[model samples]
Target: MTSKANRPCVQKLRCLLSVAVGILCAQSLAFRNVDSAAFDSFANLTAKGLDSIAQFGPAGSIALAACLGALFYRIYPNFKRVGKRNQLISVILSFFLALSIVVPRLMKLPNVSFNSFPNYVGGVPKWHKPIFWMVASIQLLTIGFTLAVIICWLMRKAADLVECRNTGEVSTAIPPTNLSIWERGVRFFDGKPMHMTVATLAMVLCWLPMLVIQGPAIIGVDSMVQLVQFRTGHVWDPMTMAELPGYVGQDHHPFFDTYLYGLFDELGLWLGQEVLGFRILIVLQSIVAALAIVVSLIWIKKRTNLPDSCICACWCLAAILPAFPMYMSIVLKDSTWVSIFLLWMVAFFEVIYRCNNNHAIGWRLVLCLVVLGLFSGLTKKLGIYVTTVSLLLAIIVIRKQFAAFLISMLVPAALVIGFVPMVVLPALDIAPGGPQETISVPIQQLSKVAILHQDELSKSDRQAIDRVLDIDHLKPYWQADSADYAKHYGYRLNASSSDRKNFILTWIRLFFRYPKDYIAAVPYLINPFVYGETYYYSGPVRCGWWEAGGSRILTEYPECGLSYTQGKIAIPLTNALNKTPPFSFIGSEALYTVWLPMLALGLTISIRRYRNLCYLIPTVVSWCSLFLLPAHQVRYTLSFLFVFALTIALPFAEVLTKERNISN
Candidate 1:
């Protein structure tokens, strides 16, 4: 009896120790100037962030408390899954987490007034740092939960292994994993057919909030430009349009797609005013996005036999996460990109994986998936890579249908790459975009070097830069985190072979010397597409300070854009998330599109789910190429995150079906 009583306490203690260790390590390194200045800066930024939270009043405290409470509710189940003793201990941790919220308010400190200073330069406040305590307490709890999960998972696997060996029999137990727990991070609601229906309706209902909040369906400067060209028929104008990169991305950005999609604007004009028409178009887009999500969830339910309760849990996340309904109404290729990608994931499983030889997937199904992949790739650069990966994974999982799989992939790719760009673009009088913005990364490296190691640079280094781009032009354009400024200095559009060779040599030499700068510059650009734990809102309408001006149409129709006031819907929420811990958890890091690959990896670790490995390779291809992509916008990680969530649920569906057969 004593042993039983103590077990929960022991587990809880283990979690506590994990939390402590993780924190101590974080603190130890947080202050240390380890050779990597970037790592040190990241740590300091993290530390200073906490201090800034405390410098204010209870706002930071409340956000911290809310985030911790959210996490506790999220992870509390893992403990319960182990046993009742673990449940009791988890409750205690929950209590402490709750105290973290209350304690900050009680631990009073003077609010650092920013009004006194002419400029509000941020620094860690010296007064009692209540927010720090609130933050650290939650950090400890999170770390503890993570370690306990790993240890518990290992122990379960070990026990299963031993039992199988002793019995001299094959192990029937599907070793429990954090996969089940990890699944919750993506699960947002109690989803069922009804729940999904409600979710879809709710998503549609938010059309107004999305419209009012996001304002102007046209998402970016480039998107607005496309809308104008399409409206003015400049899109279908002669291929002689010299600024291929200017109208879209220097020959990228899929101008053909935007040209074709111009009917939405035409419909808007036909309906009445362009604004009203665009509004209708946006609402329709939201409806389509909602339908895709709803249908996908329902299909998962039918194919996998996953419990309605679990599906319901997954539903809420689809609704609330910034990548979904919010982006749905935003007028950008990403809205379509996410929708197509989600559909592709469903089709890959339902048509390719689930239906066996007895019900061989029809040509129509294969055709639909191929079409989706092509369109998705057209909308966003990464989609092509992701689509190719899905096709590869499909071939691997459905080895018997390798020929069919290869055809599906090749057909769509050929059409998109060969026919569309080569044959169709010429017919439509559209100029083909230039190659991938490969020089972006180099410019990023150069930008960082100009700032951090400018004095360290030799004349030879200067000459090398001049060969690729004018060195004098680059001097004024040094941004550490982005190449936007530096890229202007490069002559990538028409570089000679000799120019490329010298640029490569100079770049390599600089890399050998300033390795840290290169590392810093790369992650700074790519983190938004991968693992970024910065403070931002959990909604898609981040930085809602948009207004009409960049493009000709936007300049004429000023009301066609959105400019959210401070403290209004998304900005306030985003401010809290971007500034506070746990809340910040929902920021860019939450949207890692490579999550499907990550999910596949986790499931394959203990169980040799080689079928799952198919998802990983192509996404990795997409992720690696992000370093060379143009920008690190929130939309970059969209489809990967949502689709990966679907992939995570898939294996369980497969396992459950097998289990049912066995029981029968």
Candidate 2:
């Protein structure tokens, strides 16, 4: 019989051989004194030797341990013990983890000068240096390996919960007969119209503190602008006697939202109390937002097999979360848009669910989608793009329901594309808001190039940029994270269509010619999404009652007789809530849901739960649009947070045999 490779003596000899090689490698690397050329002869040389030796021991130990760890890992590779589903999850998470590591670092990378086409002025430091590349690779691999192990362990626990859900092992429906008053009350409203009522009431109740403490409603500068427009028949900047341009009001602040605010202000005038009208408006707005949340929860409960506890938890979160109530109380377009967006998401999902299940397309659901779609587009300018793209995608995904989806968009599409621009806007004589808002991203890109690479810019590119923007003056207004100041401050109001066309052409050319600058420019855009908060107008909670430098609503419109007093106990209570647990995290823009959305998407895709994906389409489109924004405003993400809370329940369908597959 020949000696086997698995023999004990052979294994021992191999280990001994590995150790000997590792020590030799470490010594050779650490004790190389050739780079110590700075040392002078004799005395200096002796001192350098001591310093080198002192650094040698730790470096040698680390090198030897790394070699042994690599050998053991390659031989054992214990991660292979996980199931196929876990492996798939790990693969998905690995991509996300890599982005998490690379994107932030890439954002921080110094912009290297390009001396020639595709060649850097100074060769890339990380790539050119062997030590840097090797150390980075080793560190990334070590961290990734450790994280994968943790992921697998957590996934095992999740799989158990999923299994329990599938096997009907976990149920919250049954209530014992022996119960307290609160338990009895909960059981009583466990179903139907009462449940919806209770849910809506909970939200309204939570919002009351914001209303009572702040009084009437949280009136911001935008609210005053809307009031001035409706009251005076011309747009007026706060505190300034001068009127804005003749065409500035309609659809810029959105005439529909402004008109609603005006109606309430008129009611306040009729009642001799302007603030009373705002109070009524705030209460009704809260009701609408609360009802939308309830409707989505109701549909989710009926369609998915999510546990009662999860459903109830969602209801509580929407109702009790400090951020929701704060946003609800504010008088601005965002307050209205978020509610309409939530309702539209529910309608969108209803259509997809019916089509996928082969159920008949109901008239009620179609009408709801059409109506909600129109409101969504009308509430915000960006809504027009998001709604149109989403409906078009829905048509492509569920081709069999093409007629239903198309019909749903016809009215909203017509109003946004045809009626508003051609008839309504002109009839109202509102000047267009300009293209600056839509093209802020490109403007920011060009501004960066103008500031950093001015010397390298071609004459033609410079002329093209200068036609649309004040390229010579851009440096003073350019902000890394915001394009707002640059667009308004550096913008050329007289730039014609051709000028804009030239700028776009130049922007495209520069993007390809110097891609590193473009990449470097995007980190500011990614800060809020990847990390948590960015600069300006982003916070967990904001009471928009007043803004500095703006005329106070009470002072400017004193005839309307509004009061600015806060309840004696309001400040202390608000501060207490902000410092409290759960509420603090819930209200924190800093503690943004960085991982939740990623984890949800990964889990859903890994288990092939395609039906759940339909619920997330709007959020995906909305988030992608953020890259085009002038800056990262947290309020812009409010709709996403609302939809995500409900969609998170859908991934549990992975365990349900009946719901494993619903794709076309």
Each prediction's whole-model lDDT (CA): 0.52, 0.61
- Can you give the TM-score per candidate against the true fold? 0.67, 0.72
Best by lDDT: 2
Q: In model 2, where do residues sit more than 4 Å from their true spots? A: 1-84, 91-191, 234-248, 534-552, 556-585, 588-594, 653-664
Give the lDDT of residue 148 in candidate 2. 58
Give the poorly placed runs of model 1, Cα more than 4 Å off: 1-199, 206-208, 216-218, 232-251, 321-323, 355-359, 393-400, 436-439, 446-468, 496-517, 529-570, 576-583, 591-600, 655-664
Which 10 consecutive positions of candidate 1 have the poorest summed lDDT? 112-121
Compared to the true structure, candidate 1 yields what TM-score?
0.67
Instruction: Find the number of clashing residue pairs for candidate 1.
Output: 18
lDDT of 2 by residue, 1-664 (tens): 3288567775676566556544443332232232233123445544654554455456545665467444543332334555777776776675565344333322332432211111112222334445434433543454344445555654554556666766778546656775544444433234378777877887799768766655556665556667666665565433222345665464546778888888887898789876678778878888999888887777666566555566767777776665666667667788888889888887787676776676667778788888888888887877877877888877776676767778887778888767887888888876455666667888888888887888899999988888888966767766665787678677777788898998988999899988877766655566445422311121111122233322333443433233343334444445555433334435543223345556666666655566667656666677688778877667777776666556665565432345555431
lDDT of 1 by residue, 1-664 (tens): 3498798986687566545544432332122111112223446646554553445334644544444444443453354455554334334443443232222222212321111101122233323444444444554555445434543343344335434534548433545463455344223333455655666787577445544565554455456546655655443211112344333222355765575456776775677665565567677777777767766776665554344455666656665655354565567777667777787777776554443422456677778878888887777766776677667765665576665678778877777777877777666666665431556677667656756676778888776665666545566755544565566554445666676677777887788888887876654453443223332322221222133223444333433333543236666655555544433434444334533343334434434334545445445655666667545565666665556446555444332223233210
Candidate 1 positional error at 102, Å? 25
After superposing all C-alphas onto the true structure, candidate 2 shows an RMSD in angstroms of 10.7
Worst 10 residues of 2 by lDDT: 114-123
